[model samples]
Target: MTAAKVLVAYGTKNGSTAGIARTIADALGEQGLRAEARPAAEVLDPSPYDAVVLGGALYAGRWHRDAVRFSRRHRRALSGRPVWLFSSGPLDASANKRDIRPVPGATRASMRLNAREHITFGGCLQEGAKGAVARMIVKRGGGGDYRDAGQIRAWALGIARELTDVTGGP
Candidate 1:
């Protein structure tokens, strides 16, 4: 039998969220599933995949617009399959230290889509980050990469286990 296809879609401004998505996709792929990470804006359809992991970066305590729009646009298809949601934002180790809840928009999306799970991962902001505030944060020595790769990989592997059980492997 063929492996199940999974899509790890994300919305990011400075590309940190994209990195998280890639990590997730890689972990899922290692578990025998076919997974790919893509920008949320570029994905017009979620129907082609057996499962989807949607994520967005948080700005001003809100989810990225592209991710919100993607969830809205593909609500039907996404709802029909197993779906997971995540938010990346928190330029500190707080996410690694504790469970950070999703922002309002992601919470609503989770409820609407009946998402299997929602997680909040640490964000990253480094030199050359876009926007005045980001640059300022970096200049003041307040910015750094806070994403935990091991945590991300563990989460993705958990999802892979669940999906594999449901789909009878892969």
Candidate 2:
């Protein structure tokens, strides 16, 4: 039987979220699943995939506008399928957990999709990669790359398991 198609769509300002999306796609691929990772802005349609994983880099408690907009634009189609949402932000692990609540805008818009899972992962802070405001915040607060690859891989594996089960793959 053909493997189900999974779309791992994301938005990133400094590339961290993109990396996370790629990691997820790679993990899914290892499980004998068909997966593709793309930026939310580049995906004009969500109809091609059986499942979608939407993610974005969070800034000041907000996900990227394009990612949220993509979900909203395809809300009906997404609601009928399995969809997962994730955000990469809060470099500190403690902060990441505390930032669990959805941003107000995302919460309002995401209600239409009925996403199956919502997650937050620690983010990376690269020097010279931040916008003016992000730079100021990083400087004042001190920043570091706090992404835990093990944790990320575990999350991806879990999602792959869930998708494979739903699709009756293997």
Best by lDDT: 1
lDDT per residue for candidate 1 within 106-166, as digits (tens), equals 9988987889999999999999999998899899998899999999999999999999999
lDDT (0 to 1) per candidate: 0.94, 0.81
Lowest lDDT 10-residue stretch of candidate 1: 71-80
Best prediction by TM-score:
1
- Cα lDDT for residue 67, candidate 1: 88
Error of 1 at 38 (Å): 0.3
Q: Which TM-score value belongs to model 2?
A: 0.90
lDDT of 2 at 62: 84
Cα RMSD (Å) between model 1 and the true structure?
Answer: 0.7
List RMSD in Å for every model shown. Answer: 0.7, 1.9
Q: Residue 94 in model 2: shift from native, Å? A: 1.8
Give all TM-scores, in the order shown: 0.98, 0.90
